[model samples]
Target: MPADDSPTGLSQPLYLCVADELGQLIAQGQLAAGERLPSVRELSQRRGLSPTTALAALRALEQRGWVEARPQSGYYVRPKLRRLAEPATSRPPSAARPVTVGSIAARLLAASNEPGIIGFGAAIPEADWYPVATLQRLASQAARRHRLLIGEYSPFFGLPALRHQIARRYAELGIAVDDDEVVITNGCMEAINLALRTVAAPGAVIAVESPTYYGLLQLIEAQGMQALEIPTHARDGLSVEALATALTGPQGAQIRACVVTPAFCNPIGALMPEAAREALVALCRQHRIALIEDDVYGELDFAGQRPLPARYWDRSGNVLLCGSFSKSLAPGARIGWLLAGRHRDAVRMRKFTTSAGTALVYQHALSAYLETQAYPRHLVRLRRLCATNVARYIEAIERYFPAGTRVTRPSGGFVVWVELPRGTDTLALYERALFRRINFAPGPLFSASGRYRNCLRLNAGRQWTPDVDGALQALGRLVEAG
Candidate 1:
C-alpha cells in the first residue's frame, strides 16, 4: 500500500476519498486481479485511519466491484469486466416531425410492475437501492416540524430551504444562482414541460437528440409541438455539428427550442463532453434557440464527478436547467427543480397554472435530508451500485445476446442502449418477452419517428440475481429463435 495523505479539505467523505484512490490504483493495473489487499488493521495503521473507516473503505470498494472479500481473507482485486463496442451514432431524419408515441410507454410501465415479470423496462431505480428508511424518517420529522403548514398549499415556487439546497448544488458546479430563482416541479417531467411551455409555442419545432428519452417525446407530442430529431452519438451525446447544420439550414428558422440530456442521457447513457456542451450552448445562443437541459441523471456519473451541464456556459440566459432527485434518491418523492434563466417568470406562471406547486411535505423532507451530510453519502453508494449493475448488465448482454449485438459503455447512469442485428424488431421481441414474463424498453418508444426498431434500452439499475440472469438468457434464446 502507498502512503496515504491527510483527508483535510476533501470534497467528499474521507472513506470515499480513500476508496477512490485505491479504486484508481486497481483501475491503473497497479493492483492485479486476485492480488490480496492490505488488511483493514494494517491499512488503518499505515494510513492513520481508524479501523471502522478503513473497513468502510474496503466495503465501499467491494460494493463498487473493485475488490471482493473471502472467508477469513481480506479483500482482493476483482477481474475487470469485459467491454463491448458501443452502438453507432443515430441518424434520424433531419426534418422536424410531429411526435406520435402511442400507449407503448404506459404499457411498458404497467408491465414492469406486474408479478413474475423481470422488469428491464422503466429507468426507475430499484426500491431497495434508495435510503427509504432515512427518507421516511425525515418525512415524519418534517410533518411534525411543519404540521401547521401541511394542509396549506406550498409557496408558488417551493419551500425556500429546499430551493437554497438546490442552489447550493449548482453553485458547486460553478454556476451562480439565487435560491429565489428556483421553481419546484412535480419531477423532471414537469420541469421539462414547464420549460417547454415557457419557451416554445404550440406547433413550433423543438430540436432533440435522436433516440431521445420517450418522456421528452411524449411531452412534445402532448404540447402539440413538432420535434426535429438530430443525429446523436451513443457515447459522446448530442452531435453539436449535426445540430449546427440543422440550425443553419432551411428549417433553422422554424426551430424554437432544443431539449437535451447532456450527462448520462436516458436510454442511451451518453455523456456529452465539456467541449461539446460549451459548443452546444454557444450554438443555441447563436441561433436564438431555447436550450432546455434535463439534468436528472447528472449526479449518477460513475466517475465520481458530475459533468458540467450545457447550462454552465449560458451567459445570455437562454438555458433552462432542469434537475430532479428521483434518479439519485426516491422517485416517489417527485421532487424536481428548474433554473429557467430568462424565462423564470414564465415558468413560474406555467408551474402555477399546471400543478400549483409541488407537494410541500416532500420539499420539506428533502430539504431536511440535504441539510445533513447524508445525501452526499447516499449518492456515493448509489453511484457505485449503478456503475456495478450497469457493468454486470453489459457483461451479461455480451455473454447471452446474439452476435453483432452492440451495447453502450456508459460512464455514468443506470441504463444501456443495446443495438441488436438489423431486421430484429425489438417491438416484436418485446411482445414475446412480455409473454415470457420479461420486460424491457423497446427502442421505438425513444424516437419521434419510430426509429431504432432493432435497438432496445435495458434497465441496469437492479442488483444481479439468478432471476435476472435467467431472464437475460431466456431473452437471448427468444432473439435466437426469431
Candidate 2:
C-alpha cells in the first residue's frame, strides 16, 4: 500500500506494469479466457507485493478489457468477444488532382454549430469537456489586471508569457522548440494555412493522407493547390512507402510538401509508429519536401505516452509543427502556434502582414492558466475521461451498428472512423440522420476525390448519456436500413 504503488506499472503507474503483464499473458493464451485471477492478497503474496498494488493491477486490467470483476468472486479473464472489424488501409488515386471543392462545403459547415442538433458531426471536443468555468474566471481576472492591454494587439508572435509556456510544453514532448520562432495564429487551421502558404506556392502539389480532416482538404482546395492523395492505414496512419512512391511518381516532382496529423489524424484517428515518424522526416528531408505536422490532437492520447512528433526528427528544419489550445483547452480561444524551422522569419512576416496578431486578452489568460495548472496535470485527468468515453462509444457501436460495419480504435483522440458495408451510401444516410435530428460526419466530406462513399466519422468527445445512448441506438437502426 505504499504511495509509490502504480497501476499496471508498465509506464504511467505501477499498476500498469501489473496490467501489462496480465494482458500479455491473456493475449499469449497462457491465461485462458474465463480463468480466475489471483485474489488481492494471493497476488500480493505471490508477486512479493502489497495488497494495494495487486488490487490496482487488477483494476487496470478491468479498465483495459483484460479482466472483469465479479463482486466477491474475484477477477476473471473476460470472455473473448467478436469485435467489429477495423477499417482497411486506404488506396487513394496516385494522380495529383487540382483542388475544385468550393463554398458549398463551407455552407455545410456553417450550420454545424446550430443549436437543437444532436451533434456527433464536429471534431471539436464538447464544451462540457473543457475547464470553461476556470478559463472564464481566468479571462475575467486577466481583463481586470491588464485592462489597458484589452484592446491592444498581441505581439507578432503572440504574448511572450504564452509563447514561453508553449515552448515549455513542446520541450516536454522532446521538441527543442524556440519560443522566438513560434508564430501564434487564430487557431491550428490558421497556423497550418500560414505554414502552407509560406512553403508551397498556390499551384504546387501537396501530399496528404488518402482520408484526412475535411478542414485540411478544404484548405488545400481553398489555396488553389493540387492534392496528391497518399494511401493511409485506418490504425497505423500515413504510409511512408506510398508517400515515397508518390514522391517518385510522375507527379511526385510537383509535390512541395506533405501535410499530416502524425498523431491521431482526424477522421481515422491514426498515429504513425515511432519508426515511421523518423522515416517520414528522413523522406521529407531527402526529397526537400516540407513536413507540416498538425499536432492539435496530440494531447488527447488515451495511452499515457504521447507519440513523439515528426518535428523531433527534423535535423534540417524541414518540419513545421503546428499546435493549438482549441483541441486541448479553450475552443473559442482561437490560440494556435507554429514553429517553422527554416521558414520562421517568412512565416512570421506572412502572418504579421495578413492578420496582425491574435487577441492579447486570451493570450494572457491562457498563459496564466497554463502557468497555474501546468497543462500536463490537466491532460492526465482529461485523457482518462476521454478514454472512458471512447470505450462507451465503442461498446455502443459494437452493440448497435450493423454486423458488417467496421470501426477504428485509436490510441488517442476522441474521433472514430466507421466503414459501412459495401454499397452503403452515407451521403443519403446523412440526409436522413439530419432529418431525424442526429448529426454525424458523412464520409465523402473527408476527401477531395469524393471517396469514402460508405464511410462515416463520429465524435466521442461528449460524455456518454442516456440520450446519446438512445441516439446511437436509433442511428444503428438508420444504418441498418441503409
Model 1 stretches with alpha carbons more than 4 Å out = 1-83
Where is the poorest 10-residue window by lDDT in model 2? Answer: 1-10
Runs off by more than 4 Å, candidate 2:
1-81, 101-104
For model 1, state the Cα shift of residue 70 in Å. Answer: 17
lDDT of 2 by residue, 1-482 (tens): 11111222112455655665566567445788899998999989988888898999999778656689998899999876657889889988878887654553564576576777778888876674566666777788888998677566557778998998889988987778878987888999999999999999988999999798878888888899988888999888999999998898898788999999999999898999989999999999999999999999988888778888899988899999998999887889999999999999899898988899888888887888888654666677567656666766776787788889999988789998889888889888888888888888888887878899999888888655567878898999999987
Summarize candidate 1's per-residue lDDT along 45-149 as a digit string, tens digits.
999999999999999888766689998988999886544578889999878999888698888878888998888998977776777767787788888888756
TM-score of 1: 0.86
What is residue 298's positional error in candidate 2, in angstroms? 0.9
